[model samples]
Target: MDVQGVRAAYRRYARHYDRYFGKVFHDGRKLAIEQMAILPGEHVLEVGVGTGLSLPEYPDGVRVTGIDLSPEMIQHAQTRVEDLELPDVTLLEMDASAMEFSDASFDHVVAMYVLSVAPEPERVIAEMRRVCKPGGRLYIVNHFRNANRIISSLERALAPLSQLLGFRPDFSLDEFVAHNDLDVLEAHPVNLFGYWTLLTAAREPTCRGGASPDLERSIRSH
Candidate 1:
């Protein structure tokens, strides 16, 4: 889907996102966090954190930063943070494919129901890997194309409508994992009827250095 098209579609959905998606995807959200095994004081970055639905699920004392592309959706997330008086939570309107955070800035990075919606899933995963510490974990929760012939066919048939639906229905998990070179630790079905999946992986240390001093310095200065 086009980035602008996604932004426009989500702008309309932001107001009623919770009503439609909150309860339906709650289990996947919970499972993803549980598997992360987050430790206190670990810095966590959540990509595509629409409306902050998973904000309260994170344990206290972990610094949490969430980013989304849609300004309209992020406004709701900001409100959720303020309403809950959550300390150490930051919300920003930003694109996942090109994040501003310094390399290895976060201990853990997560993206829930975001891969299929991203205009470039590979770039988004690359950014997630770049910002995350080597030993840190990465979690993803999303729906992939079904295995059943009929269901899979239906998903492919609906791919053309993604611009209107805000997400592609025919995203492939196997291709995504292979293309991104993900080192998956575990994969499990989540949500009703096993429609969604939760995947966990570790960020392998890159030969490159840790957090970029210039980037971190700029981020701190702001």
Candidate 2:
């Protein structure tokens, strides 16, 4: 889906999104934040922070900057920040694939249920790696294509309906991991029936010249 399509879909869903997905996805959000282990005064970035459902879960003293492409979704998030009196949170209407922050701007970055919906998942991952400081944590939670044959086939069949649902049903975890030079720390299932996977990785420090040529080649080859 294109940016405009994403915006339109989320705009239409913003009012009722929580009603539909809030509790269902709450566990993954909580788990991701807990795993972050955000220290006091650290800066965190959340890409595709729809409606700020996870804002209140963050502890005090840590600053959070959340970005999403949908203005309507951001409006709801803004209201959430106000209602909760979350002084350290900020929400912006911005694209995840092309962030405007300086390099290594955040101490930690997370994207829950976003990769499958982003227009360019690889570009989004690159930007996530770019803005995160070396050794910083990266967390992702999303529903990936099931490995089970029957379910995998069902997901593939429903892939075209993403234009209406706002997320692709056939996103593959193996493909995403292979295409990005990420230092994966851990990956586990979350939510009911193990429908969502929580992935944790770290941004490796850049070498003298740049990232290792071999790593770049491997990612490109994939």
Candidate 3:
């Protein structure tokens, strides 16, 4: 979809975005936030931070900068941030591909369910990596194509409609990470039986050392 199309769709859905998605994706959203585990004093950048659903879950004293493509969504997020009385929070309407930040600027980057809608997931991933500090982390929680044969068939059937609705049918988590040279620390199958992918990774510093032990074991087991 073009920029205008994306903007229009999101604008129309901005007010009801959270209510519609929060209910359908309630469990997945909660799971994603639990996995983030942000700590105080950390600098975090949240991409596609629609409505700031995860804002209240963030730890106090941590600096959060939220970026989104839709102005309407950002407006709603700002209001919610004010309602929570959160300090050190900044919201920017920007493209993920062209992030206006210096290299290694963030201690952590979280993009929950953001990639699937991006026109270029790889470009966004690279940008996310670029902004994250060498030893810092990138966390992603996204819904992907189901691995189960029966479920996969159902997803295939709905692919066309889903795409028009701003959802990519399926993206290979492993391939995307490896292609971008990202050091994936951990990946978990969360919600909907291997349909949702949760991942944590670091930049180049940890790449040579390899991913975390827990992550290795999980990947090996799966």
- Against the reference, the lDDT scores of all candidates come to 0.86, 0.87, 0.76
lDDT of 3 by residue, 103-162 (tens): 999988888888877767778888988998887778888876655568668777777665
Model 2 error, position 39 (Å): 0.5
**Tens-place lDDT digits, model 2, residues 69-167:** 999889999999998899999899899999999999999999999999998888999999899998787898988888678998999999989989899
Pairs that collide, model 1: none
**Which runs of model 2 end up more than 4 angstroms from their true locations?**
205-222
Residue 209 of model 3, lDDT score: 36
- Residues 116-219, candidate 1: write the lDDT tens digits: 99999889998999999977888999898886689989999999999999999998776666666677677787899877888887786333333222221222
**Stretches of candidate 3 exceeding 4 Å from the true structure:** 23-37, 192-194, 205-222
Candidate 2 lDDT at 29 equals 98
Candidate 1 stretches with Cα past 4 Å from truth are: 205-222
User: Model 1, residue 105: what's the lDDT?
Assistant: 99
Q: In model 2, what is the error at residue 133, expressed in angstroms?
A: 0.5
- List TM-scores for all candidates, in order: 0.91, 0.91, 0.84
